[model samples]
Target: MKPELENIPLVKNEEKKRFEIELNSHFAFIDYKETSQQISLIHTEAEPELAGTGAAAAVVEKSLIYIEESGKKLLPFCPYVFAYIKKNPEWKRIVDQRFEGYDKL
Candidate 1:
């Protein structure tokens, strides 16, 4: 993570069912759906300008931390989230083993 993005604030907009962060005048977010016991991360997006800015990684990290702190299982449906976890394996601890492709992680 870039030092500038290390502490980016995360906002959970329940109405939109997404977690967001503002970065360098644009927004990066992860779309999610929640059940009683888990959150399914469905997609991740960032403004084109955010490319190479580390914004995507920052928001993903923040959202993962939030899920851990909330004590809920994670269903990382988004390919981006899965790829991110592959790089940072510690996040597998919070993932719901029943996730359709858990073995791939």
Candidate 2:
């Protein structure tokens, strides 16, 4: 099930080697730079009200799209990102390293 991008708002900005996104004003993202040809995911949190509603997943998807479009590799460090990639095969090509023992991507 693909989450709607419009419903899941994303803002991408950079801080040094990190690219970040804020989701629903509840979550913050940090994308690492210069790491094994990968984008390291960091910081993902949903507001209490948005939890269990797939808001985090939506953010991950949006972030993934941004990374893919930018032609960078992904190294999912955040637990949410790790899990999302595991369940979604279409995103596999972008992943360079997997977390939580999931290394296939």
Instruction: Provide TM-scores for the models.
Output: 0.95, 0.67
Per-residue alpha-carbon lDDT of model 1 for 22-46, expressed as tens digits? Answer: 9867999999999889989999999
Which portions of model 1 show Cα errors greater than 4 Å?
none
Off by over 4 Å in 2: 1-8, 15-37, 97-105
Write candidate 2's Cα lDDT for 1-105 as tens digits. Answer: 234434555666654444434454565444555454557787666667666666666667778887898788877777777778778888888876444454554
Best by lDDT: 1
Candidate 2 similarity to native, TM-score = 0.67
What is the Cα-based lDDT of residue 23 in candidate 1?
A: 80
Residue 21 displacement in candidate 1 (angstroms): 0.3
lDDT of each: 0.93, 0.65
Where does candidate 1 clash, by residue pair? Answer: none
Give the Å shift of residue 75 in candidate 1: 0.3
